[model samples]
Target: MKQREKKELDTSVQGIIIREMISHVTSEHMIGQKIKNGELRKKLVEPVWNVPDGFLLTEIKMEQFEMEWLEPESCTSDRVLLQLHGGGYVGAMRNAYRNFAVVYSELGHGMPVLSIDYRVAPENPYPAALEDAVCAYRWLLQKGYSGSQILVAGDSAGGGLVMALTMYLRDHHEELPAGLIAMSPWTDLTSSGESYQTNFEKDPLFGKTKDSLIYNREYVGLEDPKNPYISPLFGDFTDFPPMLIQVGSYEMLLSDSVEVAKKAKSQGVKVRLHVYEGMFHVFQMAMKLMPESRQAWKEAGRFISLFKDET
Candidate 1:
């Protein structure tokens, strides 16, 4: 293992205010109330739907799911980013991801982004999201984009999905992408990581809850929580592509990223893990407002650049 560096907590005014705001607004009770009142989607979408200028969005209908392509005004790179969004495996793709897709495209050196609205849980459940991911990857392959020219990126549950997707590809003899980028991945549905207790009170969004956000029955659906396809922390990482994982120190799922990085590294995978102190889960969503978030995205761009030209 490499020597661990001490990281300073983000004590910026914006960081402090944002953390408080998230804790107050999206606390477990507030989220439950929002879901009950049918206002969660709107509330989540309103703040992040503002797509930056100079990007174009095109919607495509798959056989069972929908995907949107976000292209820059003058994209010259052949590489593409397949984006899986995070909403605890239950939330549908919204305009927030459209904005995120813009960031991925611009920061990924002008490559186009394909963001999917994969099927979610309680209705679609376990294998549905995974199956949809496979379909999207196959679509890209059929469209003549080699797996080497693709990168898979996601946040939260979507982050875990990217790993599961890669594992599935490897197991089924399909080609893998050039790399992966996961932000605060929810890799362990078992909720066994020590951070679940250590950072419980510090996690802004999920601190108040006994279990992490995505460790619910809706998605697991009678499947083993440790199933590599579901949890991914239990998955094999042999022959996996280079990966960049970013997680916040204050998140209950912080150990999810940490443990996965350790496992991948042990299995001879190239892994870069960044633990940003004092930030909350998926803080990259605040890239426009927080310095730490911006730095995280810049790191993502640099990671993407490493394989953007690979054949």
Candidate 2:
């Protein structure tokens, strides 16, 4: 971790971070190579980390990736939240993203969610993840949902992928989702942001030299890291969808979200960016007892609702 500026924190949030989370979600288990993809994935999707009640969870095999569905009993069967789980481009998505998937299902006015388990780094590298996501979108269309009925969303690297996938779709003249949700998105794989070093120690999730050097290389392989598909901060947002960008002020990727929102807004895309004070990377996942997390979800729900009438 790098040095960070002093932060003023919400007392309750501090307590939750120190008491409830620190024990298990250490840096080693998060951004480091020590991450146990299989074990940690299961732990995240545990029933204990659920959303509003009366939701059903099921795993399904998709055309290009495995996926888990989180459907509320009263969900809009035709509308879907297509989710990409973040793991620095190297994490498992199925069990890992299930908790947040359920939350999105409840908050998007009971919109069903399909969280894709895309191929990750070191093995499937580069365009593999994006390819799988694109396949998932096509699968949704095959099921009869129009483009306007879908919302593309992701957290961390998945958030970056949301931008990449949406751009790829538009470039290829494929149907586009109504909007996008990026939670602490890692838009800059180049690690060029000041916040990368500035917010390091303040962030409980990552390590600078190690994670940046290793995982980024693993994901990029021989590709140029600055390429938009790899580092979306460098991408143009001319035809981007309505976007809601959420980030923790304390996370190193804060600049990544800020820059993305700024660029998208400048391009006349509807953009809403919410920076939570003293929060960590993808803090939205801590919806269990965090008021801010709930508030973020509420904001996301509202954004998701904006496209409801179109569907």
Q: By TM-score, who's the top model here? A: 1
Residue-wise C-alpha lDDT for candidate 2, range 124-159, written one tens digit per residue = 889999999998889899988889888999988899
lDDT of each: 0.86, 0.77
For model 1, how does the per-residue alpha-carbon lDDT over 198-221 read when each residue is reduced to its tens digit? 987777777766544445668899
TM-score for predicted model 1 compared with the true structure: 0.91
Pairs in steric clash, model 2: none
Q: Quick one: RMSD of model 1?
A: 3.7
CA lDDT, candidate 1, residue 167:
99
Worst 10 residues of 1 by lDDT: 1-10
